[model samples]
Target: MMIGTLASAMASFARPGVCKAAAAYHGPPASNFNLGRILRYPNLIGCNRSPTKKSSAQLQLWRALTTLTKREGTVNGPAGTRFSTVADGVIAHNDHAASRIAASVARRQLTCTMGRVNYDVVVVGLGAFGSSVLYHLAKAGLKVLGVERYGPVGHSLGSSHGASRIIRMAYFEGLQYGPLLKRSMRLFLELQDELAAVQGPLSEPLFLRTGMLDVGSVFERALCSAQVQGLQHEVLTGAELNRRFPAYRVPEHWRALYQPDGGVLTPERIVQAHVGLAQRMGAQVLTGTTVAAWRVEGTGADAAVTFKLVPTDATAVAASKRMSYSDATATAVPRNVTAAAAVLTPGPWIGQLVPELRELCVPERQVVGWFEIEAAARSHFAPNRFPVFVLEETSGGAAYYGFPEHGQLPGFKIGLYRHLYEQIRNPGDLDRVNRTANAADEAALRSGVLSYFPTAAGRLLTSSTCFFTNTPDGHFLVERHPRYPQVILCSACSGHGFKMSSGIGQLISRMVREGPKDTAAAAATNTLQPPPPLPPSAPSPSAVDRHVVQGLPQMDSDSDGVDWSELLPFRFSPGDRPGHREALDRFS
Candidate 1:
């Protein structure tokens, strides 16, 4: 009797024009329905039984769940009644009639419980990109929640915990990023002023305008991009760099590109500022908690994503135990949450949760160290006196970068972009101390230090180990998952993403608001809609174009860099590959 009634109801709702929108949905289907809509559908229950009867509602809901399962390519059960499909590909059969009734009751209870905790978007990972997304989404009036693994900002486990990261407009990565870089610089400056207003005058500013210089083969591409973008930059020979800076001994055969607009952005303060501002704008941020699992529950506006939380370590929980935040309207918030959409920017740990990208988003251990400079020469390492520099050595073929001494840090900070990277099998078991700068690590950096700024190699003041979530090609992975359209993948920074994270956050905000661009013309029509089908394993080349930019110009036709037409994300050159460089190339 229940199967017969459900068959009639499906036919009635399947009419050509009646469910055209529902038929257009290509993504996975949720085994859920709007209760009011189910009640209103004609003949949902035979005229023999009252429409409001509990038995009739249960049968109707059971039929709806079976229909959704079929649409989602799930296996059907005996008597055509099943609650939902499990992850292990097993068709949980319903045998007894009483068992079906119990399943319906449990599902109803779950729906009610899930409806209480709701948000438009939930961001996992509160590092550089995640925090920025939280701020932008909340500012746009979307109910947002941010989750981080560590308790306090000072824990410093991930990639965004360093004293400072360099930000420059003349990008050697690609000319296509030139516009976004320009926009990021503007936003970075604006963020500094915004943070000061709410948090009071910071003893140390967020961004310091220290000019930047790039020396090596990378300089040609960077200079060319600078010229094309009409940016302010000067091309100098090795002698000029050495003569002007005085702290460096440059090989006369090499060249350099100098841009004055470049500077350093403090990572710790940036994360804190973004979180504080986002919370004030009505976003809820939970730290020291892990998102164990999540599942999609419905479709479209009625769609809901529920996440399960796992208890963290004693240290992290204790640290965050007293750290509570009031909502924008001053209401206290609980620790758990649910949302319509979720953004996963978990950094190196993303692989553990997203099994598909495990091979692609490999976590590699990296070390960053600070070295004290002679007191008499400390003034030269200041932002105004010395510019941030990237050197590609022609001798040893290694590229190293450093930031001038700033604020409370007692020494200049430097590190090989990817020279000493050690692959980490699991991010959870990361060694924070990273072996305390062993002899090999110290010796490699010592050579570069003595060769470049001989006066600053006083002593190793401090060092810390961090993980770089590297993609196969060393480009960023910023798009919605192919299997789960509701889940956004924003990991694989590849060690160079923090500089443009502000811009990346803005781009992600639009993606969450407008959906994917190819299938849904949300940007052109100003309407938020679901995106179309994604390609297998990854998005098509045009996917980045549709969302990241309208049309990207090609990079050098025959250069060692990736083909711009392909728009491969998280792209780095063979020499630029983390910890791998040509033996002959010195200052890369």
Candidate 2:
């Protein structure tokens, strides 16, 4: 009920940014849970009401409240703690938590802070791009720091915590992703060596070079990957597909395009590896630390940009609070970088952090739920036994993918990536049940499973839900942070970015290292030329917002733009083609 009163107070503010301190005031229906806020002028925002050291969520809520309220007063919650404000003192300023929450909630502009001392090169995120870049840069002898508020690896918040991720060289997403995927698998092997966790989550091996299917509208042109790149693959008849894998009862109209190199990617373990490697290489990988704000400077090295971080030590390797990094460190150095890159791999947090990607980053409440099929039945879905599959036009008008059991998460977990949708605007608001597969969703999948492996679906047992970050064309966005030049961005996995993280990390790292320093003459004069052409398949993520929109960290450690598109399994019909019908009928 206090949330209602809190809303009214916030509504009174003129501009959300103007914040100030309000005298301690109490409201009706007081309780421990409700806290009063104090708003500062010009910046129409209020401070956290926590009487204790402000918790992160409280700080975020306070920032949201700031956008709406200016009158400082405490409203008691169920617990009955004094709904007092946090900016109760001159030294205690509005924290980074407030700024990030405001930025994410408003999705327009905000500020942030991280530590007492700012850093030279700060990796704002630790997912696929950030961690990889940190590791490579550190190894290259760069002083680097990698901070992640969610802790080592990921804390089950985004696209990084899933059990298994699919990996393949044949890309249908776009030509840009092909080289990236191929390089990813190789670096994954290298990363495995670095972590030395053989058999553990990070060390677990995945099925590779096993073909995958592209079952959507883009299958035709997507196949350019297979044709031009010569990646081993073929078009199979629905009957042949059924015979090849007795588990799938391919629908008459469904089509199957296979690329022999496709396989699975494990989420948690891989992140562990990337983080571990980055840390070992001397990059400080901090979990539970979040960037609160960023400043763009017109002059100086460290002054060009500044990021504030909040120490959520609970998740960090060591509990410490705050870290700061600035590019325009001195007023003499004019801003050299055009934009700073924010590798926004918040997984599910994509909905909140960047609302523009909201439509494309549809947050599907997918259950990583699995069946209790017999171990023998696992062969049907196993990476070696089965090429990771994508089913469209199935008997039930649905689509989904299946992965082999990696020892833990149980019998082949498979669900459509298009199940539930829960819109989130605040990162602090993420602690509830997201969308999950309902009985109908399970039933549809069960029917499809039964049609493929009649007995497998019947062996079902427990099931649960998780989430995925999606995009319209299922490709990734790797570009400069649109508004700020010093910021580069990498996000919108759309469900298939895990396997490529290794390669992606290297590319992002190279971009950071290159940081506008690459001269073409340096390459030609140095004779640092070429590798043989790699295998290819479909177009991987050609969703060119084409408007100079940002994309995955744009280069490999070698500074070469990793050609990622060649890795996609298939491309769509570009305008028209004769093989279209034949192609459509093959998987059907």
Candidate 3:
């Protein structure tokens, strides 16, 4: 009885007008029909079981017969409209084939209707990492959606809005990052080129290759890692550094490791580029929308992540501009979005989205200050003349990093690693935190500038505050949830994650594509023993370094020469505190 009723309903919708429209519509070629994707629509099929290719193709034809029957005026009208031009083209081009398939679909009692849309993957948080993930996934031909709580892709509300972020290959944190950094640099360059080819040449390149200097305690570790990775670097005394750049006033005993590949990446531009390319590749992006909650439904292959979206004021305003208030209200109503998988890269908001990580991935407030350079020394602080540098104070306090004068922003940009040591217990508190430079913040930055480059220090020009989502161990957490494998978590990159955002984005895309099979394989080989103790006088290698050194080459043939095992140390285990005791860490 139910089958007969559904068949009658489908037949009623398949009117002569539908056939006429199907014949007249010019859409994608018949060969481009994706029956598998069409069959994956459980609501349309009225069942979740996978159908054979023959049955899937037949059901797909049925979907077109029913969906295209809607009034011609309703095409592309609302969410309820289900007209698929591609499906119509298939039916129009292969009338006999589609008729036979439609007969089979009727016999099988297959039913389809316009319903809530689903995506192959949904990336929450369109910040640096999430934007990159969205681009890679879309480029791979997956149906993807990127959701950002803020307005647009490069909003200043998040950590990715800064004008300049340091990108260096001579990693002082760990040797394992060398390959990732190299890959990220290559990806960034490729991204710039790709955007240039499409959007035309940019006013300024996405990345600027300003040589970098690493000083203080981590200098030796950086030098060692540089040598191990075969990176081009130079070790110079404080006097040699000052003489070479004429922007330093380090103690004679202090030594620095310099690498020419170190440079600056425009965070805002990079994020926008990734999002723009992703959109060009058919990735849907929702700005001013927040994923209030998410959960996995079903088990195994049938599992799907459903996110409840809540619109912010920005979304409401934009919606109001597009339609009537009633229509906008209806549109703004919270809806559930379903996806095969989800990648969460919400930066400081990671804790709010993934409660399990709330305590582990803590958000800390940080400030960056730009100081005007003296007229006489302005040329010395130019990107070509000065190099990005990280100076570790002799007193073992916070390290200060600075960039040469670049971008429209005036003055030389400099920031302390954990400026003011302000840790936000609640992510919401970030809104209340003062974003402008305070007197203390200015004084601290000025003090560092005076100590290092006295000649360049002039006056406080501008300041901005952003959050650094730090983990207890100060390493990135890039892994699937402990219990929910369908939900991937990529956050808590400590403070220096921007440089590697592109590479991490690619890695997460692979993780989503490989799914549970590769995840299980990684778990089987997760026999990661703790690193051997180092001498008291020697700095301990990071967990990443130990993993890379213990015969697990950072790059392998699998997944196009990216060894997933290299990330084992960063995995979220039950009680494992990664790099907790190893205090030897540095920020970009």
Candidate 4:
């Protein structure tokens, strides 16, 4: 009987202008209609269009009814007759039932419109490097998404959370970094100005120019790099350094190099700024979510990288509360997102994500501490008075770096490079180990402070632990993955990467925009040759011009013809150790 009534109503509504208004539907309320059972009939739900041609209005009504039926799941009503025909070209149902069906139709339409999950590029980490990539990609008008494991952009869980980091033009590692440093400094300043224009002025500046002082064995290298790069600097004995900055008490025998361009950068602030500005520029960011697995699908131009996103424990709990899911398992379901390309900058977690480079990238534990300054010595340790310094106790001995008291922090910041020499084979071990500063770590930092800045080592105010994603050669790995060219592997900065993150971001963005280079020939030959050098008369901008340029040019064109592939190659050979100079031939 119910089937007969529904059939009759469908036939009547199919006629032109038969049921134009609710008043026309004056038959008995079809409140007890069995949608679950009716769905089995092909003709009633307009699924079998081949049987007969149906009116546009009839098709619309039937489609809405089918959508409502599937979404609400067996909407139960009376089993007996409920729908009835009252007169010619008229049908009727309860007003409440009519409104419920309309609501369901609206919801189904909304769901259909809001289900797009495709992007041009997806950055798989929101650390210093990843955030910058996201911002640059978004600024270039690409649809980009940034995924972060931690809840906040600048959370302390990763390597980018230190309050302050050193930024200097005179790189002691190699002269190859000169071009990158110059470009990065320009970008950092431009970012500051851009943020000020959009979000008003920041309370704290992103880069602070306090200059940098390098002492001991590193002095000669720094001085040479500074001279070659045409940077303004001063060469002084330990006594001259003490005379210029009263806070230090260096041994008179040690030589020191001071470059006026070096300064301190607020790491947390830079990360946050990049993320916030990226979001404002239409970049999507997913925090408290992690990528469980990812792969490249298809080949050539049709290739796409898909990532499976799983919420962390904290994210799952928050989502459950907001959604009111009865079963916790429902909220834990993983979602997949597809992108044309992906940039992997997961920091220490890079090894876990890409097992191919596990041995190449290792995470080492590090500790940093802040020591209170004496009341009378506070003036000398101020940011304006004292410069950031790196001291080597003996030639090629353990080196220590420190920053003058600045920001809200209560003491002068100091840390030992590769502190404790504790290596973490498994990235997950970081979570299990104690993160608090230990007594032994504090004692080591205090000893360095006593040897150098004795006046600032009054008391231990606070301390924290962080990790360095180290490469075997103490350089960085900035290249596409060996197996998947669509996926770029950018990790293992060996502790001094944060400063060059801006330039790195620009490099990755250009790679994504131009599509992956065709290195198949090189792979086929199994011989990767270094890029050729620029002509002697090539017009290269000076360091000063690079720093103040209005429009930052591409790294290839503006970076003094430095080939990044030679500086940081992607090839990984186990047990094959290449000297730093071999990798960076420009410096040699």
TM-scores of the candidates in the order shown:
0.67, 0.60, 0.74, 0.70
Comparing 2 with 3 on lDDT, the higher-scoring candidate is 3
Every candidate's lDDT: 0.62, 0.48, 0.67, 0.67
114 in model 1: Cα distance from truth in Å?
A: 8.1
Tens-digit per-residue lDDT, 1-588, candidate 2: 334433332233223222322323321111111122232232222343333544344345455555434332222323222211121111112333333222222321111221122233566666655666666655543335565655445445445655566665546655556555556666666666556653366444532334577654435544665554446567777777777866666664556777766666655666656655545444455556555555565432222355555654343334221222111211221112112233444565554554554554455555656776765666666656667776655333466677655456567667665654444435455545443456775775676566555546655555655555555456665544445434455665666777767666666555554443322344335321223344554443221212111233443222344432332222223234223343234323
Question: What overall lDDT, based on C-alpha atoms, would model 2 receive against the true structure?
Answer: 0.48
For model 2, where is the 10-residue window of minimal lDDT? 27-36
Best by the lDDT measure: 3
Give candidate 3's error at residue 156 in angstroms.
0.5
Q: Against the true structure, what is every candidate's RMSD?
A: 14.4, 19.3, 10.9, 16.2
Compared with the true structure, the alpha-carbon lDDT of candidate 1 equals 0.62
How would you encode candidate 1's per-residue C-alpha lDDT over 108-151 as one tens digit per residue?
A: 32221122335668899888899888887765545577877776
Ranking by TM-score: 3, 4, 1, 2
Query: Which ten-residue region of model 3 has the weakest summed lDDT?
Result: 320-329
TM-score winner, 2 or 3: 3
Scored by TM-score, the top model is 3
Give me the runs in candidate 3 sitting further than 4 Å from their true place.
1-117, 314-334, 523-560, 574-588
Candidate 4 local Cα displacement, residue 135, angstroms: 0.9
Task: Show where candidate 1 strays beyond 4 Å.
Answer: 1-117, 315-336, 394-396, 431-435, 517-588
TM-score of 4: 0.70
